[model samples]
Target: MAEKAEDTGVIAWLVETVKTVFWALVIAGIFRTVLFQPFWIPSGSMKDTLLIGDFLFVNKMAYGYSYASCPSIRIARLGVDIGADDFCGFIEDREERFFGADPERGDIVVFRHPVDGRDFIKRLIGVPGDRIQMQDGLLYINDAPVQVAPVGTFDEVWERQGPLGNTPSCSNGPVGPGSICQKERFIETLPNGVSHAILNVGDRPGDNTGVFTVPEGQFFFMGDNRDNSVDSRFLQANRGVGFVERKDIVGRADRVMFSSAGRSMFAFWTWRSDRFFKALD
Candidate 1:
């Protein structure tokens, strides 16, 4: 009788364990299939905007369901009915939920890289049907030059490697100073609505020429750190970063949750006290 009772207790514990595991799996599946996800900043592609150690929350719902899993594929039949399957992903979704009414100009968007499908974040510069060009290190959107007003001082506001005048992105033209990162700044505007800041690091052979067209359902993006960035210019030169699909946008940078800088070995741990609670443009 004693042995039987012990065996019964062990069986009950096993049953409870299985139930707990099942529920956990179900909850995880729901979260992954819906709601928001997280992404870490791995590189300096959008240097001045997103830093290397910053951790961000990606709003998957911002653009609706993008990665639905299934085995079936849709293929067009040739003059007769037939089971369809092909290398191209053309299966019609049973249910569709549209997200993001439209991507705003200058909106910082996170997207799947067209070249390799890795997630990338960049600001929208050109939209469908717009012609873009670069002139004398300055950007020209649809024949109108962008306006960049001098706002305080980037060097004073942000902690670069050196003093206010020595930012690498500022070392050319009217402000060109080898002694400092002398370059000009501007506020750029794109057609169909978007405006943002641009940092020109001056006369790098890479920034002087290019005429681009933005196709429907695609956008042209670039980083603010002009000379220091690998953006639509480089992406298009290689013909890889040409167009970012609308469905790829993750979400806008709503706010700057935190910022830390200076000469501390643990820069993250050394928080910028005043800069805390500051909003991102």
Candidate 2:
């Protein structure tokens, strides 16, 4: 009889353990899928505004819910990929958002690529019916040049950045490793009076662009790093991100939760204390 009691107790403990794990997973899935999603800055395209290795949580509720609100999980190192559409693909065909609202100009937004399902984040530059152009590295919106003032030069160590080990380009070219790489920085004020810092790394083809009229229901985005970004200035071919659709927007990035300058976040010594909980413009 004692032996039988022991077996029943063991079975009860196992069932309780399984139930606890199941509930934990269910809550976490809802939290990630409906509340906040974490993102890490993987490139220097946004430059002074957002750096590589910067980690932040995207506020999915900012513009209400859409098919893109469903998280697309992809961990390249782990070989895991579950597309956002895999969760909410059925509603995507309807092309409507649940409690949807439009994102404002100058907002830093994360959206899924219309062609590929990968996520990309950039400053929202133009909205529907707005004409955007770049003339001699200066931004022109609706035939008016936006206000841009030179603030200073943004300098950083000319070393490999992030896990990709990509090197930074300098206005003063070809600097040695551990040396300072400089990029001209400017403060640009949009029509709505939203101002942010932008970096210029000499001239490139993106410096001069013909006027692009943002299509209806679509939005335009651009990186803060002028010469290095493959944003709306490029067409959506060959892995370029063109104009993004409203339904494709995932969320707005409001703050940097944490940041590390090193390749791995676990390198505690490399944590950027200044950027912890840093708010975005």
Candidate 3:
């Protein structure tokens, strides 16, 4: 009789434990999907402003909830290729968002690609009905050139960076590994008086683009690393990000929660203590 009672007690404890774990996971998933989403800087396109290994959380509440607020878990090695559409696709292609608000110019925004489902981060340069152009590497809005002042050069090691092992582009030619790769840095003030650092790696094709008139309900974005970025300056048909729709906007990146200089975040010794909780300008 005592043995039977002990067995029943053990079974009850196990069942309660399972229920607790299941609820915990459900709550965490909801929190991540509707409140904040974690993002890692995977490329150097926004270099100087955002580094290759900086990690941040996108504030989903800043611009209200959209279908893009749903999380897309894509771990290639694990064969997991989920997307926002897979989770909240029924709400996609809708022009309206729940409690929607527009993103201001110069805000660092994350949004889903108009064609592909990949997420991209860039500085918002043009809102709807704005004309954007780049002439001789100078940004112009509505035929008025934005103010740019030369700052010091941005320097980094000319070596493989992050897990992708991408080589940094330098204004100075043919820089070898272990040497300083330098790019001309400047402070660009937009029409709205917002200022941010931008890098120039000599002249590139994107520097001489014709005026692009942003359509209604769409926004234009560009990377701070002007020459290397494939942004709205380029066409989406050619693998570049064209104008992004308002419904696709996920959230704003306000701060770097953590940063790792090494290839993997698990490398404790390579953690960058200085960038933790560093607010973005």
Candidate 4:
């Protein structure tokens, strides 16, 4: 009888352990899908605003949930004619809740790759019904030069930009040393007086040329690391696709939660002490 009681206790303990782990994962998934998700900037595509190795928290509910994913919005279960959703471009959801809003320009955002389902972070440079063109190292939005200027203090980093479709070095960024973190970077000005800094490495792609028109439900994105970033400019070869879909947007970047180095990713003990707690713009 004693042995039986002990065996029963052990089984109950295992059952409780499994239940705890299952619930923990369920709660984490809910938070990642519904509330906020944590992300780390792996490259300089976002430059000054976001840097490689910079980790941030993205708001998932800024828009709403999408039926295209999760059990709630399953097409087979919820059908196509759903109600309000937190997902972008969804325009509707399940419980009959409704809200109408769209992402605006100059907003830093995270979206799903058009080609792949992976998430990416970028700035909203072009919107629906906008004509964007580039000529003579200038950005023209609606046939006007987008205001950009080089500042003494630049957030760009110079890097080894390889050959890019006959376009030579355009992004002149930096191969920054110990200060690989985002906040250590400086600023740059776009042609339109939108004074923002992007990472510029002395690569060859800043000279990329193409005219893009953002579609109704899509948005155009570019890396702040003008020279080194492979954004909409390099879409033809990007696995994530050139344009971002509305459904991929997870949240708007509010501020930098923390920053570290590219190496800090491996040996966290090597994190630069001075690069901590610097407020993001």
lDDT (10s digit) by residue, model 1, range 113-232? 654445577787888787877787777777776665554323322224311222344443333332443335566555544555665555676577678888887788877767766667
Q: Which stretch of 10 consecutive residues in model 4 shows the poorest summed lDDT?
A: 160-169
Say which prediction, candidate 3 or candidate 4, comes out ahead on TM-score: 3
Clashing pairs in 3: none
The residue ranges of model 2 lying beyond 4 angstroms of the native Cα positions read: none
How well does candidate 2 match the true structure in TM-score terms? 0.97
Native-referenced Cα lDDT, model 3: 0.94
lDDT of 1 at 26: 77
- lDDT of candidate 4 over 1-281, digit per residue (tens): 99999999999999999999999989987776667777777665665566566777776556564532332232435455321233433442232212424666767777655544456787777777777765654566777777665554443233422112111123332225423222223353444445566544432544646778888776777766665566665664644357665654556676676776534555566454554554554
Order of candidates by lDDT, top first?
A: 3, 2, 4, 1
Clashes of 2: 0
RMSD of each: 9.7, 1.0, 1.0, 8.0
Q: Give the per-residue lDDT of model 2 (tens digit) for 67-131.
A: 89998889889999888999889877656678788999999999998887888999999999999
Range of the 10 consecutive residues with the lowest summed lDDT in candidate 1: 80-89
Name the candidate that leads on lDDT. Answer: 3
